[model samples]
Target: MSDRAEKQTGGLAAVAGAAKQAPGRGLPPVHLWHPEHCGDIDIIIRADGVWMHEGSPIGRAELVRLFSTVLRKDPDGYHLVTPVEKLKIKVEDLPFRAVTLERDDGRLRFTTDVGDTVEAGADHPIVVETDPVTGEPAPRLHVRGDLWARIVRSLFYELVETATVEGGRLVVRSDGEFFALGPVGAGVE
Candidate 1:
């Protein structure tokens, strides 16, 4: 490995050690930790929601999930912050992707690619943004803190399939609340 890659591996190791020290009951309070900026890492989250490091895909799912716990998005960019260090990482799109959806007990829950389960309600709402240039759909769901899960195209279609028009808005009802997907007359697809 090059010297830069070698240096980043140490940061990863430090993050792994911190993850090991955290309690397994809930996620680490990354928002509270104001560690010193330790520069950027080689990690990159692709538009397809794949996590890569050093030009290769990270094969371990658990490790990826662990690193995600420390992820934070600021006005600058996304960073993986531990208690002692904060390392920035590149995100092509959103840091996470909602790959699956479940409806149970009149609640719509989304499962992210990294195993984060978020329900669409008052706490976690869904929003859609159309590209200004291409007019492509980009749907996102608030997960936690500043993190959001990108709703994949297929899942967005599924949402659209179950949507209904309410007050001239294309919306989906979850947990007794209506979330607008788009205007009633606009073609979301």
Candidate 2:
């Protein structure tokens, strides 16, 4: 491997080790880490929710899951953070894809590709923005701490199916909060 490639591999290993050692069984406290910024890594999260390293997809599911625990979105950009290092990475779109959705007792819970389960509510709001060029809706759900997951097409369709017309808008309720899926009769049916 080239020198840079070797360095990246070493960096990844270090971060992985730190993540394993992190306290608690749930998600790591990436938000609490204020490590100094290390240089960028050649990791890219594609728009389709595939993670690429050195221009190739990372085939190891466990590794991806481990890295996802340390992912944090700062004011500048997305990063993989450890207690001692914070490496910037490129994200073509959101860092995750909402693959599955479940409704339980009037709450919409979404599961992301990386195994995060988040319920849509005031804290994790769902937002739909229209693509300026294609004029299509791009819906997203806040996962945590400024990180968002793009709701997959199938799940978005499900949302549209269950949505109710309220005050001239198509809305869905979760956790006592009403979220507008889209304006009523705006070609969203």
Candidate 3:
């Protein structure tokens, strides 16, 4: 392999090893690591939440989940970080997809494709942006430290079903915070 490719392969193994060595059952403390940038890897997180490495889909779900635990977002880009090395990756959109949602006692909890569960509230607020050209609403929930999950179409539909009209907008309440889905009567077209 070329030098750069070899470095990337070695870096991937290092990162996977570091992630597996995480002390407990929770995610690695990637936020606290200030490792030197090891350069970019040919990993791409597609808009649909598929993790691709070297042009093929990363077929191992467990490996993807493990890698997700070490992901960190910096001002420059998204990275997989270890205490010793940090390598950037490309994200076509948000890094995760909110695949399922549940409501309990007025609070909303969402599960991402990578197995992250986050409750929507002040800290993990939900936001919607309208496409300038299509005017369709794109909703997302903050997952963690600069990472957000695109709320999937089905979950967005569920949110709409539970939304109430407030101030001419359709809004849903989760953990005492209200999030606007869209303006009332806004067509999806």
Candidate 4:
């Protein structure tokens, strides 16, 4: 149809082939890479546009729509990273509520400020007895869900990313490089 579409459908295969052609984003330690990047899947770093079947970017609006849709459709999956591996949390840090994880071109960040911090009440134990003369357990933490991690990892999602709508181009990036998601539909809003 359009030049963008042609590139999206055809040359994108070569672009997808460049999956091995990893760019030097100089990413921080926190921005995690996806576990799988095989047939029909090209996961780019700090990229722009939508994720396509050919495993390439499908332009801007398309990418935004798909990302929003995936988020709305699979709210849980949109926040956490994929390839769910068991992580070690503290028992003393349990009995909390929500969590927030942010990803930038920099690193794979984790934040667990779910709810307001309440004073340690009688309902919860002040300290966890490990051996004999130990102290309190410590501050609590919660890992984000799977879908969220996938969305974050796949698109390099960030919470405070500045999105500027100029002349129809959506200049969206975290820290710097442009990014987007795939398998898109209409814009959510």
Candidate 5:
């Protein structure tokens, strides 16, 4: 490997080791870490939520989770911040994908690809937007802080299955809150 490649690997390894030592009590305080910008890394989160590094898929789920812990979205763009360095990463769409969902009582719980679980409620609301050009539905859920997870196609279908019309809007109730999926005429009425 080149010297730069080696440095990147060593830096990532150090971060992973530190993450392993820390208690698995929620996400790390990445917002507080003001490390020096180390420029952009060859990391890309594809639209489908696959994490790619150096034009290859990052095969280790643990590493991805570790990286996700440090992810931050600044006014400029998305970045992965460690104590020592902050590396920018590209995201074609949202950084996470809510691949699995479970209905808990009147609430809905979502599990992201990176293993973060979020419940839809006041703190975490589900929002659906229509693509102005393509007219396709783009559904997303707030995971934590400013991070969000895009609801996958299958999970969105499941959510639609339980949808109801309220106030002329297609809506679903989760966490005792009613979330409008779309207008009643969007085929959900």
Candidate 6:
């Protein structure tokens, strides 16, 4: 197929079609996250109409279409998580890193500057949290500083930390007896 005539179909559509007919490269679930040295990133791409993570079950038809985009062109339609409109990260740990990723099977490949190459189940869930909620019109998120990556990271950490905590004083102690320390005016004789 020549470029001139191939332009008739949209670039993505054309590629998706081609991949459907090609052999298997073993489509892996694309994982995106921030690096440990940097901030946290817990974002989910809802715009793609489909929410499939690493190891997610997909019919061959869907896999072909997705692979076509990756095989044909750069990752533009890939689903990535973010906080509201900006990337989120904790401010206290400013000037850090954001590890974004894309994965398949149990293997993962780093897509950004901050992260590591490791194996993670494809079904790993990223809890999407929003302050203003998804409805109405308010931006559904929170972040530190003005960086989009910061926002993304912060939101991710916040979600994970909160989920791990059962009651919620802050830290999730493994065994310590959480004794109440005296305050400034508690009067400890």
RMSD vs true structure, all candidates: 1.4, 1.3, 1.5, 21.8, 1.7, 15.6
Please give the ranking of all candidate structures by lDDT, highest first, separated by commas.
3, 2, 1, 5, 4, 6
Each model's lDDT comes to 0.89, 0.91, 0.91, 0.27, 0.85, 0.26
Put down candidate 5 lDDT per residue, 1-189, tens digits, no spaces: 998888777766666765665666767888788988877777899998999988999999989998888889988899887778787889999999999998878889999999998999989999999867778788999987587899997888888889987788888998778888888778543
Residues 45-155 of candidate 4: C-alpha lDDT, one tens digit per residue: 221112333344436543322222211112211211122211111112122222344444543234322222222222221121222334321222212221111122212
Clash count, predicted structure 5: 1
TM-score to true structure, per model: 0.94, 0.95, 0.95, 0.18, 0.92, 0.24
Name the regions of candidate 1 deviating beyond 4 angstroms. 1-3
As for TM-score, the candidate ahead, 1 or 3, is 3
Q: Per-residue CA lDDT of candidate 3, range 105-154, in tens?
A: 99999999999999999999999998687678889999999999999988
Candidate 2 lDDT at 182 equals 93
Q: Model 4: which ten-residue window has the lowest total lDDT?
A: 84-93
Pick out the ten consecutive residues of candidate 6 with the lowest summed lDDT. 136-145
The superposed Cα distance between candidate 5 and the true structure at residue 124, in angstroms, equals: 0.5
Give residue 116's error in model 4 in angstroms.
21
lDDT of 1 by residue, 155-178 (tens): 999998888888887888788877
Off by over 4 Å in 2: none
